[model samples]
Structure formats: C-alpha cells, structure tokens
Target: MSWSGLLQCTAVEKNGRTVISDCYYEGALKLTRPVYLHPSQPTIYLIHVGGGYVDGDRYKTEIMLQEGAHLIATTQSATKIYKTVKVPVQQYTSAYLDDQSVLEFFPDPVIAYEKAQFYQEMTVYMKESSTFIYGDIITPGWSESGELFRYDWIRSKLKIYYEDNLKLFDHLYLETSTGMTGIFQMEGYTHFGSLFVISPFMTQDLLQKFESMAARFPASVHLGWSIPMIPGLVIRVLAHETHAIETIFQMIHQFIREECFQEEPIFLRKY
Candidate 1:
C-alpha cells in the first residue's frame, strides 16, 4: 500500500553553541533526541519504526542548517529493502545549508532482498562556502536459497547545488535480471560503495593524498578515485566484504575531521 513519512530538523546558533531548535517527524519515521557531542555540532539519528521498506512505501526527510551551524545525521541501522512483486520502495532526502554550514550524511548500507526494487534520491542546496560529505553503500541480500544478486533493480541519484547553480549530479542504476555486462560485476565483488566530498577545501594535493591512502588497502579490494565531472571528489570501491569498505570510510572521515576541523571524528554508538 501507499505510505509516506516526513522528518524535519532545523538548527540554529544559540548561546555560543549550535542546537537543533525544531525537530519533528510524522508517520512511520522517527528521530532520537538530539545529542551534543561537541559545542558546534549536534548529532541526530534517523529511525524507521516500520523496520524496513516494502512495496509503495515512501519516506522523506528535510534538514535545514542556518549560518555557521553544524550537524551530523545518521541512521540507527542499515536500511533494508524487502521483496516486492511489482511496486518499488522509494525514499527522498533534501537538505539546505546556509553560509559556512557543515553537514555529514553517513548512513549504513542498504540490503536488497530477492526480487526487490528500490529507489533513493538526495538533494542538497548550499552556499559556495558550505561543506558536505555524503556516502552510500549497497550489499547483496542474503538468501536461504544461496542465490545472490536476485534483486530486480536498484536506483539512486544525488544532486548538489551551489547558490542555485548545479555543482554535482550523480546517478546509478543496477539490475540483476538484465544480464547486463559489468552492471553489478566487479570481479565477483558482492558489495559496492561511493563517497562524495564537496567543499572548497578539496585541492589537488588533498586528492593525491587520498589516492595514496587507497594504496594501503588489500588487493582484493579495488579502490578507485576520480575527480567527478562536477565540482567534487568521488571515491568508489568494490569489495567482497562490506566491512572492508566501511573501514576505509572511517579512515577517510577521520582524516577530513582532523584536517578541516582539527577535531576527532565522532564515533556514534549504535544501540
């Protein structure tokens, strides 16, 4: 059936600290109480009480960060897409960042069950001085029948705008039943991941540093970096185990935190 959920979070500076002034949710979506891990940054967790997305299920979230505000948004767990007959599971997120704001959207991976169809779209509108980091990981769902890549299809799009000008638009689509060459084929990898870093801080030297960092990963894990056709840095990975990609993500996040903010990365405790 048709189901939709909405969540909105607005942050503003108060008393020398950035705080979530208004937080609200409706329908199957929910949010934990905002946590202040640092003075300028507040952390929020996205929760889906329905457990997983099914056919015709829709969920949306919007985040507004005022000038100089900082926020970290993550999910309590991985988003699961169950089997579907015809309809698809859709989700959307829109974020608006004022001047000099910072946002980190780092959620767990999505596992698509057999015959499942999933779609996700994310849009970010921000000033030229804002900093945003977004990531997505997908893994083949486990099947008792011992079959992999049985899902019908999965599609995702991420678009970012700088002061009304489109700066980045990334789209991806994978179909398991189409017999398409190299669609989900990465030397037998079962999972894939992509990370986007959008900020004025990205320089050629920093991109080279990231390339050097990828060299330390095992040969089994294929790591590639490319300067996106847009105005950002993109890193892609193909791995047999999901944890391998996650470990590298942690390293990159840590490096960004230290280099940009001179602070340690927030280790979110998953309950």
Candidate 2:
C-alpha cells in the first residue's frame, strides 16, 4: 500500500459550463473523466484501483470549486473496508467552494468487514450562498458466523464552515465495546444513513414539504430530518435494507433537483 495517496481536483466555470481546471492523483486513488449528464453540472466518479481498503492504508481527496462552478462526485461502487489487525484504514476529504458554487457527493455505502476499523474526516469551506449536498450509507459487512456488527469500530467527523465561521460540527462514532446491539447502539437495525444539505435554497416551506413526504414512506424505514437551520439541515435514517433508505433519499434528491435547481433528477448512468 502507498504511504500517502492523493486525488486532487479543481473545477472552474467557463462559458456557463463547469470544467475541470486541474487534476492530479497517485497510488490507489484515481478519478474518472467528468461526464456532463447536465449541460452545466459535471459528474465525476472516484475509482479505487485496489477495489477495497485494507490495514494501514491512507487516502486523501481535495476538491476546489471556482466561482459559480458546480460538480457532482460519487464512487464507482461501494467502499469496502476489510479486516485489520493493527492500524485502521483512514480517509480524509476537504473541499473549498467559492461564491454560488455547488457540490453534490452521493457515494455508495461503506461496508466494514469482520475485525475492520475505519476512520474518516471531512471538512468543507464555502460561502453562505454556495450549496453542498452529501449523503451516504454505513453497513456491516458479512462474517463467517453471519453475525452483524463484526467490525471493530467505525468513526467519522465532519465540519462545515461558512466563510470562516463553523456552522456545523458532527461526530459519529460506533464501537463494539459499547455493545452494538444495545438500544442506544444499532438497536436491531442493520444499516444507518445520513443526508446533509447546506444550501441557500432550503427554506422552511421546503422543510415542511419534505417532512410530509417522508411521513408517507412505508413503516419499514425509519427516517427523520432536522428543522432547517436557516441554511442547513440534516436527515438520519435507519432501515433493515439498503434499498429502503436509498428510495427515500432519491425522492428527496429529486425534489431538490426539480424545485431548487429546476432540473431533472440526476442519473449517474453507471451501467
């Protein structure tokens, strides 16, 4: 494994269309070419040549968006963290967004296999007018005994700043030491997902609309959203299956695309 792997990219607006101004990557982390599913927004996929992360691996991703540039990024597939005896697999991500820019990151779930330990830290610096949407799922990997929560632990810390002021600081940590089966822990749930949106377009009216929409979903999925904190909101979901949470997030994503961006729902076109 490489000691330190990096995937850095910068995007800028040119003639009303966003384009990659610069990109550099090495080791296991690589980026696919930008695909313009939408004329203005480019979708880029992050690829892991090794297919999965293992012990003592370290990765970093840095993204820069010039004024008015918009980008959508996702992984080619689910991120799998395998068994580890020593150092935990680590990933660090940072992004800078200029005025009126946007970034949408909707990666697939991360599965931690038996005895795995993983850690992630992400930070974003953006103007109040800039928009950011990020969502992901965390799932327990399969084990020989068919026991869930076989992984050692998983942790992630996220920090969002608006023009030098910290707007949100979220920390999620779960360890088997605390009994993952406990009520405060996984609580018999098999998966957990989160969606975070910080945009000028999120208003109280939209929040109400989403609340009503989420309530209509079937009882199999458990999901809730925070009240709009003016420019930011959070949604947490727990479900027995991955598709249940994914369906809910997809509807919300479609709403944002149509109502706020005046565009059709994005199709990643993974094929």
RMSDs, each prediction?
2.0, 1.6
lDDT of each: 0.84, 0.88
Could you give candidate 2's per-residue lDDT for residues 1-271 as a string of tens digits? Answer: 4645799999999999999999999999899999988988899999888989999999999999999999999999889999988999999999999999999988888999999999999999999889999987899899999988899999989899888898788899989777886687777888999999899998878777777777778698767778544486799988988778888778888888887788899865365
Provide the lowest-lDDT 10-residue window in model 2.
Answer: 221-230
**Candidate 1 local lDDT, residue 47:** 92
Q: How accurate is candidate 2 locally (lDDT)?
A: 0.88
Candidate 1 lDDT over 38-106, as tens digits, reads 756888889999888888889899999999888888899889999887779999999999998889888
- Lowest summed lDDT over 10 consecutive residues: which window, candidate 1? 178-187
Question: What TM-score does structure 1 among the candidates reach?
Answer: 0.93
- Please list the residue runs of candidate 2 whose C-alpha ends up more than 4 Å from where it truly belongs after superposition: 1-3, 228-230, 269-271
Q: All candidates' TM-scores?
A: 0.93, 0.96
